[model samples]
Target: MHKKFMYICFMSNSKLYKGSLTTIILKLLNENDKMYGYEITQKVKALTKGQLKITEGALYPALHKLEAEGLLSVEVKKVDNRLRKYYKITENGEKETTNKLDELAEYIKTMQALVNPKLA
Candidate 1:
């Protein structure tokens, strides 16, 4: 029973992180002009105190998808003989971020109301 409960908790947390990946990336770019993949992953882990972590496998795919979608622009830089891709938000990305955030906020409020009717 305990193992099942733990597994469910882990899955739930992973789903939340996956759902927020786009928002996380956009918000990070919004705060800074640009950031490399590793930096973005570390920032999210630090900001969430390790509660939220982005696996490279998942992060790269999302970044690539965002780039393909025209929401992100990338610049490559050489550091220590290795190339790093730094991402920044485009103008359209900035506008989209604002709209998405508002929608997420409303969704959160509605969920909270459902969870705790008195709080709403």
Candidate 2:
């Protein structure tokens, strides 16, 4: 079935994003002004068409690390009687996003050359 194929493909591809997770978060935050943890997860899922899922265990630590690194800032507010934390990219984060994106682009090119040398 198509669903089973997609599931298998997604499972294999999931590990590809591990090194780029922070860059992914930074790029997403750069595109959007601010996002809560769950919002970021949903956005990634929607954008990837369910191929990639960001787990809470992985997501929270990255957010915390970015915050500590001075690249992202957080705000807390109450919504629907529940407190929610929102993350916003700092000015430095925008710069880092650009840098990471450039690096990723180059990495992709290198991978392409190696993976499909005829195309390269």
Candidate 3:
């Protein structure tokens, strides 16, 4: 019973975080200029009160895809005998972030209307 409950919670939380992954990454980079993988993950967890957790598998692919699309740029740095890749939003990324945020806000408003028609 406990395992099943845990699984359900995990799935629900994953859904929420997955939808906001791009927004989260963009906002983080916008605030900090750049961040490494672990830093980004930790920041999201902390800021969201552990509600939003980013897995390595999900994060790396998203970061790589963003880099490939020229929305983000990366810098590799040596830290404590290991190389860490830090990501920063490019100019295109900054503009894209604004657009995405606007679209997301509109989506939320639409969802709210569907959920509670009187509120719309």
Candidate 4:
């Protein structure tokens, strides 16, 4: 029963993270030196206790967009005879991560005030 409840909660969290996916990715990469696509997805799920999973379809596109915007730089390295692309945050990406985090924080504060006004 507890596992079932956790599964339901995880589904809801997945929906919420979709909109904030890029911000989450930027923050994660900021903390780590570099990460591959699959590594990023696994880290997010692990950190969120399986509540959040970044789909590959969603992740690759966001990485490409950030790279195009100069917010990220990618390096390709061969491991086990296969090439893997690792992403690292750029100087601009660090600055953008700060701004994005501040924006999200403000939004959360506004949401708290509105969702539970008595606590505000």
Q: Best lDDT goes to which candidate?
A: 2
Put down candidate 3 lDDT per residue, 5-82, tens digits, no spaces.
453223133344456778778878877999999898888878879776777667888899888989899999999998
Per-residue lDDT of 4-88 in model 1, one digit per residue for the tens? 4443212124455447778888988987999999998788878878777677767899899999999999999999998899999
lDDT of each: 0.83, 0.88, 0.81, 0.84
Q: Residue 112 of candidate 4: its Cα lDDT?
A: 92
TM, every model: 0.85, 0.87, 0.85, 0.86
Score residue 83 of candidate 2 by CA lDDT. Answer: 84
RMSD of each: 6.1, 5.6, 4.8, 5.8
* Candidate 3 stretches greater than 4 Å from native: 1-16
Worst 10 residues of 1 by lDDT: 5-14
Instruction: Give the runs in model 2 whose Cα sits over 4 Å from its true position.
Output: 1-13
By lDDT, is 1 or 4 better?
A: 4
Displacement of residue 67 (Cα, Å) in model 1 is 0.7
Q: Number of clashes in model 3?
A: 0
Worst 10 residues of 2 by lDDT: 4-13
TM-score of 3: 0.85
Candidate 4 per-residue lDDT over residues 10-57, each given as its tens digit: 323335554697899899999998999889878888897886766666
Full candidate order by lDDT, most accurate first: 2, 4, 1, 3
lDDT: worst 10-residue window of model 3: 7-16
